[model samples]
Target: MSDDLKVTAELRESFGKGAARKLRALGKIPAVLYGHGTEPVHVSLPGHQMLLILRKSNAVLELDIDGKGQLALVKDVQKDPVRQIIEHIDLIVVRKGEKVTIDVPIHLEGEAAPGTTVNQDSNTISLEALATAIPESVVVSIEGAEDGTQIFAKDLILPEGSSLITDEDTLIVAISIAQEQDLGEETDEAPAEEAAPAAE
Candidate 1:
């Protein structure tokens, strides 16, 4: 949960849609940082650098503003539907050893029994982990698993200090036999030729 990402942000005085658009034109992302009963601070972050840091799941950020370091987590991100560019971002300030609940992706390992298909009911599980050490993903093994086998959330072996926040009975993965698709028979019907007598 180390804040591997460090970036500098500038205070943004302007507000509203027009201002946000102008910032995007300059390759800056408008963002708000607020948490722990603190006032929301508006700022502009470097678009390219933020994009690269966000490639990882649950990215933790160490923001250096005016020589003051603040630890934060990405809470929400708004993006343009068509352009797929960052529109606005919302961040929550956090501190060391703080427990936060976040969704961690499930990684499937190995193959299930032959002729059987692995049906994953849930791809991510909710975990209560330290803000600085949140897991990137959890791996579940289905190797040699037989049909009708189901894995539940409670059965997951969590990382060192993380705990499952999702319901224990939640179905994570289900191994079942694959159903074969059958195509309907094709018709051989063809259009009849017009009679030449009509021309007479």
Candidate 2:
């Protein structure tokens, strides 16, 4: 959180769907910044620059607005699926040391013990971490784990200034036996009935 992300932004003069379409046509994204009990400020950002900076989830953005500096957090983003472009974004003003709950992805590294398969039911863990220093993701080691072994939220080791916001017993990952594939020809399992001798 060293203010590594900086973007050039300007005050949005016009507002509405038509105005937004015009901005998009000009390769700019319409955005709003509101938080900390301040009035929502409408602005426009460079589409390319904003996309690059938003590569990281919960990105901390430093906005240079008309030569003034503003600290903000990426709270929401709206995008077009087909075009893969940023349509709009919402930013929340935040200060250092403020806590926020966000989902940190779970990274499972290393192969499980021989004959044991890894089942990842939870890919991200919800935790309360500093808005400024929130971790990019959470790493859990399943190395040499045996079958039926489970790792829970309470067992996670958080870095300083971070706290567990999710349930303690929430299962994150477990080691289990792999399912065997059925490769044989399919057949109906209903048993055939025996016939009487010549209907006697």
Candidate 3:
């Protein structure tokens, strides 16, 4: 299941650090909405509400501003390192039903074959999906994969309403034999050379 997020925003007229700090004290998050060739709009959103909606990565927000509705995609989130609070957020205006390219996390699942290891070449891949229906992430399986086996972007199963924008040849992940396992092989034959005599 997916998360449904809606945020209410008020048109903001003030700008700069002073106004922003003041807004923060009142638990409002200063934000800007831009993109789709429209002029930027400054607004203040409820901080608590925005935080709840932002917990999910790549969240799509339905912004209700003065009874006006618009589709918004999270572009950037500024945080205060010390407080771990969201200082500001940038939302890109998007149209419903339009495909926008974004990176979705790649989830590694299942264990590889015994004595083998898995190495992820890419953490995420860009995909063109419906603005209002963007997926949370892409999942790939490595169940019982042996050494030298590789998973490519094209091999991923995209969620409904999502399409791959990355190159089909791009390496997504790979599995290989563990070094210790390879070194564990022993020889039956004993060494021909004699060891040096123990010190007297």
Clashing pairs for predicted structure model 2, backbone only: none
**How does candidate 3 fare on TM-score?**
0.86
Residue-level lDDT of model 2, residues 1-200, one tens digit each, is: 35458888899989999999999999999999999899999999988878778888777787888999887888889988998678899999887778888888888878899987788888888888888788888888888999889999988877777888888899988898765533222222222222344454
TM-score winner, 2 or 3: 2
Better of 1 and 2 by TM-score: 1
What is the RMSD, in Å, between candidate 1 and the native fold over all Cα? 6.2
lDDT of 3 by residue, 28-103 (tens): 9999999978999999999887877877778888888899988888899999999888889999998877889999
Q: How many residue pairs clash in each candidate?
A: 2, 0, 0
Q: Considering lDDT, where higher is better, how would the candidates rank from best to worst?
A: 1, 3, 2
- Tell me model 1's lDDT, rounded to 2 decimals: 0.89
Candidate 2 regions off by >4 Å? 1-4, 181-200
lDDT (Cα, 0-100) at 59 in candidate 2: 79
Cα lDDT of all candidates, in order?
A: 0.89, 0.84, 0.87
The full ranking of all candidates by TM-score, starting with the best, is 1, 2, 3
What overall lDDT, based on C-alpha atoms, would model 3 receive against the true structure? 0.87
Assess the local accuracy of residue 82 in candidate 1 as a C-alpha lDDT between 0 and 100.
Answer: 100
